[model samples]
Target: MKRSFENPLIGDKVYFTKYATEPGSPASIIDVELKPGGGNGLHYHKTFAEHFECLEGELSIQVGKEILRLLPGETATAPAGSLHRFFNASAQPNRFRVTIDPGHPGFENTLKIAYGLASDGHVNKAGMPKKLWHMGTIILLSDTNLPGFFSLIQRPLAWMARRAMADGRFKRELEPYTR
Candidate 1:
């Protein structure tokens, strides 16, 4: 098991961070502060649910068909496969944290890839590309954790994740990892 600072959004006044606990557990914590009109683009997790808690200002979270406005000390949860998005509608960046259940391998590695792409000047302020989608399938097929048929699916699955990350719908905040 490895632990370190990886997520791009970590700092005192700008953004927060995400951390993975233990190994093989599907969970992560994301801390963030969104500036006025700043928010996370719409996305969904097919593997685990995401819960959020507002630490400062007001947070506007959209879970499926319902949009919720959570104030300080408030919290909300979005179940797996639910379309969810969050933002700050105030003058200051809204501060909050997200916990994603059911972790995955190279969680930090994925962020590094996205950040590397962004640093090359390919990403927008929102961090999302023009398009992006599910790339988890790629990891599953090529993990090498299992042999036989599972290994056979690696190439195709990785191809799909690459394509989705290149042109998926939601953009993730990314940064190179450092300890």
Candidate 2:
């Protein structure tokens, strides 16, 4: 696996610095850098929690209904099943460390796929996949759930993803990024 991943479309860079190799350590840890005005949409994970610790600049994270602005040395946690998002609203870049407890391999692969898609111009300007099946595949693998009414379509999206997997399309797309 690559040590670093970059989403040029969204101005986000993530460096995988730690993994669940130790007996008693973080499942996954990453150093993240978000360019000014760069951020991700609100979404929730079905498993694991993300502990965001700001390292430089300002990191704004919205966890559930509250928006927390963290500075250097501050930390905020987005527990599993909580709708959350993060961004860099500052004029300069924002650097933070995200620790995922009980790490998930699918989630890690999701980032690689998404970033690869962006680099290949398979995603839109907003960094979303251009194809529905691709979107479904990503959502299925990432454990990411959309908010509100969009959540209702999770089943259908998952179905599409499963179909792709069954047809070997998923393997074709994922193999380049993962294994």
Candidate 3:
């Protein structure tokens, strides 16, 4: 199935427009656009390393406490297990392509969780619902190893993804593609 990640952070700044599904191996191409200072907070993927190629503007990449500045036409890799974050540091806009290997099934949902927490403006009780939902969604989407619960786990995700994409809420959430 095809899906788009509606980021709850910048309100549709970036979009995970296409997803490719192969039986065993996982991979995806993401089109990313970041305005000055726009980026996700610090985080790491447990099993996915995203190789990024800049299509426009400059990007500031932060990996494990070190900052690297990347210009247009440059490429960088954020390996799995590394704490990394990136942002558009230039005055103008920036665009890039992120090719993630061994696709991460839980990446999109994790953004929503982080956005929800940020929405409350503090990591406190108000954001608990979002945090819980984030965790729950991940379990449902990724815990296919559980016995007899595969269908139950996947059904809600399918429904939610469809609804979000159709409503334009998905686009509003991602806010990742704006110049």
C-alpha lDDT score of every prediction, in listed order: 0.56, 0.86, 0.58
Show where candidate 3 strays beyond 4 Å: 1-12, 22-25, 108-131, 135-179
Candidate 1 Cα deviation (angstroms), residue 177: 5.7
- Which of 1 and 3 is the better model by TM-score? 1
lDDT, residue 94, model 3: 83
* Pairs of residues at least 3 apart in sequence or in different chains that clash in candidate 2: none
The Cα error of candidate 3 at residue 155, in Å, is 24
lDDT of 2 by residue, 15-102 (tens): 8877545456748788999999988889999788999999999999999889999999999999999999999888999999998887
Clashes per candidate (backbone, < 3 Å): 15, 0, 14
Predicted structure with the largest TM-score when compared to the true one: 2
Which candidate gets the maximum lDDT versus the true structure?
A: 2
Supply the TM-score for candidate 2: 0.93
